[model samples]
Target: MRTLTLGTPRLTAGLDQHHRVDHTAHRELHGPLPQLGADDLITLAGLGSLRGRGGAGFPFARKVRAVQTSVLRRDSTARVVVNGTEGEPGSVKDRMLLTRAPHLVLDGAELAARALGSPEVVIGVADEGARAADPVLDSLRSAVDERGSGTVFRVVRMPDRFVSGQAGALVQGINGRVPLPPGTPRRTSESGVAGLPTLLSNAETYAQLAVLAIGGADRYAQEGCASQPGTVLLSVSGDTVVETAAGTRLSRLLSACGLSSARAVLVGGYHGAWLSGEEMSRARLSRDGMSEVGGTLGAGIVLPVTGDTCPLGETARVLRYLARESSGQCGPCVRGMPALADSFVRLLSGEGSPEDVLVAAGIGEGKGACAHPDGSAVFARSALRVFSEDLSTHSLTGGCSRPVKGELPLPDGYDTPAHPRLLVDWSRCDGHGLCAELLPGLVQLDRNGFPEEPDIPVPGPLEGDAELSVRMCPALALRIRAPEPGSAR
Candidate 1:
């Protein structure tokens, strides 16, 4: 396979040489990883101004210092975790780093472990089809056996869901629990995995760390822009992988990718904003640069939306996937996501009101345990604003005069509609009458103050109120159950 690339190569320097880098090849391409004290790591990271490759864009130096300080305060060893779980459907830089350069990532993990005085390192991979991550798992095992590194490396498979890759959820999974974000958000660096202070970062961040350690700060800074130094791996259109300097212009990248013209572009993944062709042409590929234009280089994804595809229809499909992927732990996410998705679908079909879409999108923000709700909300809001003319056409006349070519990529199994049924646990019910009061339309009080749900599945119209009632239930007895896959809807 040919690797399409631009700018300086550090982490993916020698991927063209081999499928998987063995210990020997790893040592050859990048020499021995330098051992660093905690202070040294912070210094190098600060000098390079390295940001987390994950969606958060947190400073790497601050994160390292946080873990070190936390471990010292607790008087315990810190556990280092490499988050290789590329859960974002539109991103694949993490998987590529793991698959082609697992050893480089391990080298960074080992460095972090040494700096934190830890004995173990955990590499978490997304458990999707398993076929995509199999090579990385095999390479990890091979590296462990061949290198005989003193540090204990464990490979854990994370849940394939979007929110499962969150640092807290990944830690929970590593601790042998279902990979879901805790209701009360906690910093994994403060307390994680067997209650030890943990240092966790994205896979590409670790690979970059390895590069910084081996190549030294001065050499690393030679590449990329002043604000952000070093190279970034981008998964363009889910097919072509490009390694470019941080400040490369989006227009230049697109030109290199052979797209002469485009209607619009999505900087970042699904959570990121949409930019017009002119705006994107002027925007830079770096995080800071993209931010200037109300966009983000989140998860290293840059997908162009060609004029032929209907942006509204593509957006509706994505919203549908996001709605289906909701963790169901949060009421707003469970309810608001479906409402937003269904509303978008209706709006696309020229049947729904734009006000309902706006309301659902507004309600979804900041109401969940994680960023899923907020991200989806941002995506929807951006879509509505970016495609205003299209919305006008659909709303006024009920037609855009264009067919949806499905330009945006939606993964398999997420396209199916969610047929949800509400289930109430009689044992936990105390009959405070709040659920019935909140959603009188969906829940009716029986003789014994028990709630009686309708015989049919909860209709989409009542979903918002139903979820609110579920959330407000004093006994936590209410829950929504989705139909099993391939089961009768």
Candidate 2:
């Protein structure tokens, strides 16, 4: 990767070797700064839809307004937390900034702290690799040593689980509470860290803020799209991994990094969607334009689904992994994800029928505490839209017979248990087989009498005796899927 790229196109120009915190370009996080005048930050954010790098794609304006409002209104103490914790796999942009450009992220955090009258600033990060975390922390320490009275900013080590970085969970952990989101829509802006109004955002988002603080709006807007005038960092991975001999040139590397040519791009990490490896038609990468095509800017990690990889099978495996990642906090998500995974696995094997698709969409829809389930559903549904030809072949053949080559996704290991399904207490199961009757494609019956669903996606369109068999089962073990992401029509 290019260690120092400046004034380039996309969200990466400001990035140094470090992904999350790039302090090399900025001066210090400060001993303190002038309190932010109302509306100063709103302008500093470029007064545009500069989207947050975090997958939520929240507007920077809204965040500024929230902090701006809190500053203008609330009386108690307020704080800022630069959330460097990346719970999602395939995400390393933040780590890059933290390890290499620590100063920049700290500057942004410090700016927010000073602007919002937040005396305290906490940088929360959890690393998947030990080696990556220390450099980031050390860089942070140096920034602090240069400014703070040795105490203005703090870096907190968060729990390693994927669930830890969640806003509510992060608040809970900092406060010595459990690291889990509350069941309600309680805002972190209301309570954070330890009972203080907090302005918290992903590490990369803060890094962008620092970039804006120093570079000014004109420099930042130079190469970006008119809508989202900024560059982004993407972690590019390709099939047929190539390690060059000592003589590999920079240009060849850039091409491989996806600066040239067209291929399926996995944006926003795993929760992102796949784009057709169309022509270089997609000349630049940004937010709104990608969404117009059913994709997101994501967390800025772009993994290429190269030609050699079977996009279908790879998508199937990712769906399954994301399904398991569900926190199981909500009834729809916990129950629906497994069903969605099963439906895709079936489609991969060519066993999925028409009825299966409908139910999978139903189960995986808006049922989760967060948008994870809905996002995964969007991924699956879009994959079906893009790969209808593949689906047709699988339907005709009764199975893809492709051996599920492990491409298009990182290895999640083999033998992971199939996510659990809704079960019927046979004692409660009235033999009415309501479940089998309701979702016949999903649930069948064994000899003795119980719903038996193949651990795969049930294709849409089922009928006849097999359908009748499930219909007879009264126990309703056969709940259909939720409406699924982006599938209301």
Candidate 3:
């Protein structure tokens, strides 16, 4: 494939030191990954502690086995994709590997590609900084060029949108479709990238693949806890102030980036939880580890929150932004999130109700199309849990009164959520009759005016989004929102 290299985060971000694979040597070692016998790969992965890098930290063996079995039963060419779209706001590990150690990342992708029948290995990238995409591209090119053996493929530079980093959305974008997440269930390993049985994983996961290739399972298992082995990259931006041992419980880790002097840490992404005080301090960065703390190791992203701002207000702003980021494919996410956002806003403004809190927590606690709903719900729940003190404070007095510091990241929340209740943007809209006519239960029309929607809950399907309402709207003002969370699978 490409001239491989291994080991990254040259800066040694966290407290732990990662023993990464040497991509160059890793390339030489790829002499056919010894066709792992049944459960052998999973055992090896488990031994190596091959936790998924996509933040969720699902065991590689779990996904590997799932994809392996799925492909074995189906008679189709299995495919693979290295999702390099690192879109979480506070996290920067995947692109970090790409920019500095492209070969390592590519070598990882190649190693997995080889083990999995050398299926189409498409490395996709769309980093936060324009500068980020180049390094990975250069590295992938070099690795492919060096192999001359022909197996590696091209690196696709994706458009840098928030959800474009999602595995399904990324696959859809690569296959020449809108870069939005899908609603109905579609597994990447089952049907991904051109309707092929594909094995799509995050960029860091690929790099880890290369590492596992060269290190073998034993070398991979050397570090980290037993439940799940390996060192995980964590962005400590969640904490803004340095926490002392007494005030913080920082994981004595291989790499705790940005944790030098922190307050709280956003354990997950935007949809992640905000753990403050000892909660942030004591937390570790691993699937098994984060799980122990009621937080997840999703996408390997963590933001440490310091005293620079009020955690409550910061979370509120982030909630609003996440609401907008909803693909608008499900109702729970499209509308429910906005409502929750408003609740958070009201709380921040000292104009909230206890009922608001209870309702926000209950609405989609169970029903929704995707994990976006769950993710948002988790964020809301965790926010309430941690910031409850703030809410109580606000209730006692007028409000936190702290300015809604935009410090909480709403990476794309600003541009999307201005739909203005029912106002339509005609030029951008073509009445497919979807908004008004599609789901008459959810929407209706004014006596002598435009279309209108009732307060009915939206159905999960896009048609429920009311294609007729969209078709009928002279201006495409109505957007269908899917209320679901995204899984690494």
Candidate 4:
């Protein structure tokens, strides 16, 4: 949990001041966080126009209202779930909050529980490989005994997949299921986590709530812009974490990070848009400000692209990652993403048809159960728009005339997606056609009575029958090879 402060630190107030993780340090540095009733909290959030720190940027007050209303209508105790799964490859601010100021986040979570009458609070951190790496988990364990609030605290490590951070996915994961978004649209605020009305939000949202609670609405609004008055934590590459006021100009941030010479910037994380150097100079760091320049403050990641590398090639690598991280739930996300990546690959290799990339992007928009496909579309479309010259060079001569330096920050050690395929060990086969008989839709028999493999990965619906077929195979020749590490099985 490295830290950097460009302006005043609101969420990270005590980190640089006290620099301690234990209870005494937290209390002595920032004092106790104020407890507010549900109505007061809602009012404070509405006055500040607080938005979720997660990519969605939905209104925090509205979410609180919905959860409160649902719990009232159902006459049940609501559960508060804190989502600390920072799955965005380029963002680490959430990890910073979790490690440096665990109590601040817990303060926010406890306050929410008191407001909603929720006795239980669950904090979902990712597995050890990703954001839930040792530093954060250790901080959380140490903070547990220091909690003075009466609310029960439970910490669960989520799966380290990209979509596992989605509200629905986190809810599903907490309930002992695979952390994937559900097929239908069911709001977590209404029905979540074992059929209880749940108040769920990302890690940074809770941290902001803590700041508002401790400092009051007037003090909280003193720093940021008029539209959204608050501070935001930004992950500017893995090297530095910047905390600045909302509505700060992108150019100012670039200058502060020694990136004034950058030609273009990848605003937000991978799912975010790209801004040209000219557009970036006028862009603001706030939500409305980013939208004015055709971008959003998604995950608050601002990565500058210098002129030294091939922009098209860099975008192509991120597209490949986006394609691999798909949940395989919808047609557009499963097929369209790979097609988009392939088009970029061909363009980088000098054989691309320009229309294929845009066409694939269009096909993927709004076609997934989750926002994964739509985000991929946004990234692809923005790359095409912002890197037109690079695209032109690649399309014409199959090369951008510049070396690929891998400037864009991609997830470390992200394995390629391998679609689940039927594999046969021929030595163990006895020419049995049982596998073909059990799942005739996927398997076909060869002339020698051996099962002929299907070309595509097995669909999720057929997994039951496929597993049954594997078990029923008399000669043990048929089996399904699991998909690659980052792929959806």
Instruction: Please name the candidate that would achieve the greatest TM-score relative to the true structure.
Output: 1
List TM-scores for all candidates, in order: 0.87, 0.75, 0.76, 0.86
Output the lDDT of residue 131, model 3: 61
lDDT of 2 by residue, 1-489 (tens): 334232342234333333443333344322223334437776778554456777777877677667666655667668888888877656666776676666657767777777677777888887445454476677778777755472288788876555566777777777876666656646677766666678888887876776666666786766456677656655455222122211122234347654555345565567677666551245245666566656765766556554554567777767666665555455555457767777777775578853685577677576556666677777777677666777788778765545555544443442243443343445545555555545543455677556554332322222233344344545443322322442200
Q: Candidate 4 lDDT, tens digit per residue, 242-325?
A: 899998898888888888999899988888999998899899999999999999889888887889988887888788777767
Query: Which of 1 and 2 is ahead in TM-score?
Result: 1
* CA error at residue 148 for candidate 3, angstroms: 3.6
Cα RMSDs of all predictions?
Answer: 5.4, 8.9, 7.7, 5.3
Q: What is the Cα-based lDDT of residue 420 in candidate 4?
A: 56
Per-residue alpha-carbon lDDT of candidate 3 for residues 358-421, written as tens digits (9 for 90 to 100)? 5875665556545666777787778777777778888778665455455555454352332233
User: Residue 61, candidate 2: how far off, in angstroms?
Assistant: 3.0
For residues 15-79, write the lDDT of model 1, one tens digit per residue.
77787777899899899888899999999999989889888899999999999999889888899
TM-score of 1: 0.87
Give the better candidate number (2 or 3) by lDDT. 2
Give the clash count for each candidate: 0, 63, 82, 1
> Model 3, stretches more than 4 Å misplaced?
1-40, 127-133, 238-261, 410-419, 423-435, 438-489
Rank list by lDDT: 1, 4, 2, 3
lDDT of 1: 0.80
Residue pairs with backbone atoms closer than 3 Å in model 1 (clashes): none
